[model samples]
Target: MEATQQGADVFFVLMGAILVFAMHAGFAFLEVGTVRHKNQVNALVKIIVDFAISTLAYFFVGYSVAYGVDFLVSAAVLDGSAEGSPFAKQGFDLVKFFFLLTFAAAIPAIISGGIAERAKFWSQAMATAVIVGLIYPFYEGIVWGGNFGLQDWLSESYGAAFNDFAGSIVVHAVGGWIALGAVVLLGQRKGRYTSDGRVVGVPPSSIPWLALGSWLLCVGWFGFNVMSAQSVEGVSGLVAMNSLLAMVGGILVALIVGKNDPGFIHNGALAGLVAVCAGSNVMHPIGSLLVGGAAGAIFVIFFNLCQNRWRIDDVLGVWPLHGLCGLWGGIACGIFGQEALGGLGGVAFMSQLIGSLAGAAYALAGGFAVYGALKLLVGIRLTPEEEAQGADLSIHKIGANPESEMAPR
Candidate 1:
């Protein structure tokens, strides 16, 4: 029986790993579509760099902090295993590791989106190291890492805890906050805003890429959401069915609001997935659909507001789609996600509000502290000359045409 249980754990780990691994293709396509063609190569390079840096960092130290060197403690939480057991035996299942890696990889995609077109590639690369290597893992330990640290305290004290099943707060919000900080430090992209502060439109060269990216993300989102439960036992076939329903809800909302606009429809699919991520393992099928539809509607309204009102240059719509919708998911979990799914009995809606604010604040503060320091020391933004020259050519020295300094503005 013991041997059988161990085998099951291994199977879970491998399956989750495969699911998370598939997310990379999603990230690649999504990011590729978001950036202008002038900077397409640059976008691809950043994702590659993020993956490399996150993997090494997670293996060397992050794995310890998150899974814990006191591997027994985490293991005990999982299966009543002894504390201080063999590191190899107690660590995150291969599936969990793969899932976490995908989470780590997702962070830099958000960063790349915010800083697209004008960022110095080296600066972006350096930021990627800081985020995955240090920032994310530390917080991840507190949130999802076993042994129940801060998040557990909040969960118990408030209601069910700071319940983020798939990381509306853990991954998406962290990425969004870092993206926010990077943008603040890097400043707006050239031609994004006029001297008088009017916003300008920079149409993408290929909507096809964006569409492809969105579709891939929709598929990978299954892994991103369902894998959070950590087992087929915790996440059953019903949960998977709910996820499908949620996607349908999001699509329906997008169609109504988008009213024949293909771009909005594509983006709506991603918005739905991000919206459902927080409570995919917990919410009812109907609940999931409502949450997803709300996210799609919110994405359209709020994103336009961010563009027109705030003039924040989030090139890939990360702020509204991921940041705002991820927050919605957190709060949704508090309401619709029940104790059985991971919530506290009689979960107070207010507790969810507190968690959402707290997560956002933590992310914002960390991002400001880290990226702000980097900006002051090394200078985060590129020179005007470099901005005019496409980042691919200016920073990387490779582009579609070596002689072409910049992609046409």
Candidate 2:
């Protein structure tokens, strides 16, 4: 039985790795296609660098936080009468490690969109360490770790516990809030706002890249959502169907609102994927669809508000799709998750909300402190000349082949 369980876990872990691996291509296209062609190489480079840093961080700190200590240690810490696990076994250590690795990859991708055009590459690379190593794992352990003293109330109330099966909150919310912090500190991209304060439209240099990235992301999200089930039961099939429905719902709503904007449609699909990520584990297909559609609508409303009304320029709509949709997913879990899945007292909704809010706060505060300190110490933005010329040359050593753009500022 132990062997069988281990085998099953290995299969699920491997499957998830493949799915998560595909997300890199998705991010590569999504970001490169969205930014100006001058920055395409830099954008691609950021994805590779961030993923590399994330891999290291997850292997070290993330694994320890997410699945290190046995739950018994937690209980013993809380109640002296309880005995801790002497063997110190981690639950499917390999599986947990791989799962968190994907999560680590996702965070940098989320932040990359916000800082796309002008962020210092080294700064972003440094952030990958803080986020994957210290930030994400700390919060993830608080919510999902076996140790009870920290989140024991959750287990007591909701039988299996604070369930964010596929990381709608852990991965997406963390990414969203961190991105928000970076954008707020980094300020708007050059010429993003006119002299009169009107927002400028920053169009993509390559439509094919943008469209391809969005499509690949849509395909990769299937692993992001459904692989969490880790089983072939009726539940797995249902979750898969729900993911499809939610994507459709998001696309439909975005199309209606965007009408003439293909960009909106592309963003809407991504938003839907993020929205359904949290509750896809337990919700019915129709429920997942509703959650996804709602995420799309929220994107239109929130993204517009941040850009035009609030004057917060999120270059790639990260705040809306990841942050806000993650928020919605937390609340949706309260409404849709089964009581049986939750536990006893019926405060699963409240717990989910609390956990989500807590996660957001940590991301925002921690991100600001890190970015702010780094900005003051090493500088986070490029000089005006560098900004105009593109980060491909200034931050990275690579230069565009065009002789007209070869002069260093």
Put down candidate 2 lDDT per residue, 260-316, tens digits, no spaces. Answer: 477778888888878777677667777777888888888888888998888888888
Report residue 243 deviation for candidate 2 (angstroms): 1.2
Worst 10 residues of 2 by lDDT: 79-88
For candidate 1, write residues 186-228 as lDDT tens digits.
6778888888967888777677877887777777777677666
Which residue pairs in candidate 2 have backbone atoms (N, alpha carbon, C) closer than 3 angstroms, thus clashing?
Answer: 158-342, 158-343, 159-342, 159-343
Clash totals in order = 5, 4
Reference-based TM-score of each model = 0.87, 0.87
Show where candidate 1 strays beyond 4 Å: 1-5, 70-85, 88-95, 146-148, 338-347, 400-409
lDDT of each: 0.72, 0.77
